[model samples]
Target: MRIPFALAALTLLLGACTVSTGAEPEPTQVAGAVCDVPDDLRPARPYRIPQDEVAADVAVAFNMLAVSWSPQACRSGKDYPDARYQCAANQFGLTLHGLWPNGADNKHPRYCAAPGPAIAVETVRRHFCMIPSPSLQQHEWAAHGTCGWDSPEAYFAQAAKMWDGLNKPDLEAIPTQRLTAGAIRDAFVAANPGFPRDGVFIATTDGWFREARLCYSRDYRPMRCPRGLGAPDRERLKLAPKGVQQDAQRGVQTTG
Candidate 1:
């Protein structure tokens, strides 16, 4: 499936741009992720993106780095065919959701402009490892990128740079019993010294780990979230193990 033509047109007119951890314990040091780009990958299909209150007109307050737990995202969408590339392999751990610009009082900008041209196929292929979904990447560019960036390339480049700068914790190594929202936050702070203790905002779905939204300054320095978003500190969390095929099908398990 291809992105809608209207969205594509908007994209052509404007290009542009665009997570967490805890520390109760020192998290296990895992090797950096190695993404195996798929040779047969295709562009994402059309997906609806909800409109929001503001657009490019809103003053940029702070930035947000949204990261999703791949297993949870995949498991939830396992029945859908579009999800195959990400869900079928179960090779991903955390993945980029998007970089967002926020305004005061919880009002964020979105769908800043109509969709322009479909994102360049090469651009989609380039970041497929980081986002895993072509449609999502395209949607992000249309919904949020237009507000802050002049082009798709610049938007994605900034997102990739921020994503690369992060030191992610290995969730698979943590015992389930210790996986509370606060524990996850602490692990992130431990992994990156300058990161504020309240910087990471844990998001969950039915108690399962969802996304981690980390707050940042306009210049991208770590900053405390204005108001904690998503699950609370003491909330118990569940996560599907990384790279385990069966775990993806059965959902998250509590095992040490």
Candidate 2:
């Protein structure tokens, strides 16, 4: 699930480039104008990216990330020369389930029947942002099941583009979530050659980890959450809350 972004966007993330969110933008004054406008502000417009559009863009992203099947793998080249092609089966997996707000319980397995490491780009995205989760939303609509599209997150996110569009907005608009440093590492580890934990993935659409902020053991105990926000770290001042992350066990169920 190593989905590559546009080269320029990739560079921006890798370089950890700072866009002007923190500091005040310089002011611009027009002739005979007493009021000054900030140069950094984008045009203000209320946007509710339609579900169809969100699914479509998401689909484009998924296709960009999906593995290509060669003629051999497609099985149409059985009559052709001995040629190796991409493996269509087990290429990648994803699932956008109903938001498991209550949290995953003890019965939650370390490995999900879905979202294999092969295609976990969306998984990584989940760890970072919570809202505008088209995949999760679509999964909740679960009256229909699409094959080769069982991975709920993959299909829903893409389908969202068709049903609606995904937009980037702040605070009152886009649902954003933050990751504990641990959660970020956990995702990287999940994609590692042989991650020991199965179903060990933590799913949260909003908020940062309480235990993580409190310095819990690397062992990620969803059941052992410390109460309330504790001592502040350097970045604590910069933290935003989509709402606090509940105990790990809370993810066991999703609210329909």
**What are the lDDT figures for the candidates, one per model?**
0.69, 0.24
Please write out the lDDT profile of model 2 over residues 1-256, one tens digit for every residue. Answer: 6556787555543331022234552222111111112223221111222333122111110111111111221232211111110111111112112222111222211112223222243432332112122222333323121222466465445433322211111212222234343333244234432322222233222233211111122222222222222222212211223221221221122222
Question: How well is each residue in 1-256 modelled by candidate 1, as lDDT tens digits?
Answer: 8999999866543422111023221222112444545556667554444443336567789999987777776666531213555655426777888898877765677767766777887888677767777767777787778888988889999998888678677776678898988888887788778999888988877888877889999999999899875677889988866653322332211110
RMSD of 2: 22.0
**What is the overall TM-score of model 2 with all chains considered together?**
0.20
Best by TM-score: 1
In order of listing, the candidates' clash counts read 27, 41
The C-alpha stretches of model 1 lying farther than 4 A from their native spots are 1-34, 45-56, 78-81, 243-256
Runs of candidate 2 with Cα error greater than 4 angstroms are: 1-164, 168-243
